[model samples]
Target: MASLLAAVVSAVVLALSSMLSERHCAFGFGGFQCNDPVAGYGSVLLTATLASFAILIVSALIATWKLVAWFRAR
Candidate 1:
């Protein structure tokens, strides 16, 4: 259950990041502008998405371990 929740949350974050990226930074002219709000926002989202993925991975590992233990006990 925890893993499932994590997976769903991670998927949502990924979708949001993709949507934001698609909506911004499309023009063929750029060179690392520090004052770009879109870039800053994107960076924050990227960090969040990465952290969510890490949580998802850990949850998955826990779920798998529990399942294996249950099967072994049965």
Candidate 2:
């Protein structure tokens, strides 16, 4: 259950980070564009996404371990 919760949280964070990274604004006339400085194409976003994936993997492993243990116990 804990691992499942962690996986869900990480998935949410990954989705939010991906959305923030893609956020942009367009200007009129000149057709200029602006992106969020914090989340725009950079290492920060990449790191966040990677971290989330790592957490997800860890959670999945934990869940699998618990499942296997349960099956063995029964």
Best by lDDT: 2
Clashing pairs for model 1 are none
| C-alpha TM-score for every candidate | 0.58, 0.65
Estimate every model's Cα lDDT from 0 to 1.
Answer: 0.65, 0.75
Model 2 lDDT, residue 57, Cα: 91
In every candidate, how many clashes are there?
0, 0
| Pairs that collide, model 2 | none
Candidate 2 displacement at residue 38 in angstroms: 4.4
* Model 2 Cα lDDT, one tens digit per residue, 1-74: 99989999999988876676556434447443346565234456666778998998999899899999999999
Poorest 10 consecutive residues by lDDT, candidate 1: 26-35
How much is the lDDT of residue 54 in candidate 1? 80
Q: Per-residue lDDT of 1-74 in model 1, one digit per residue for the tens?
A: 77767777877777776566566634345532223457656556556657776876787787788889889999
RMSD of 2: 6.0
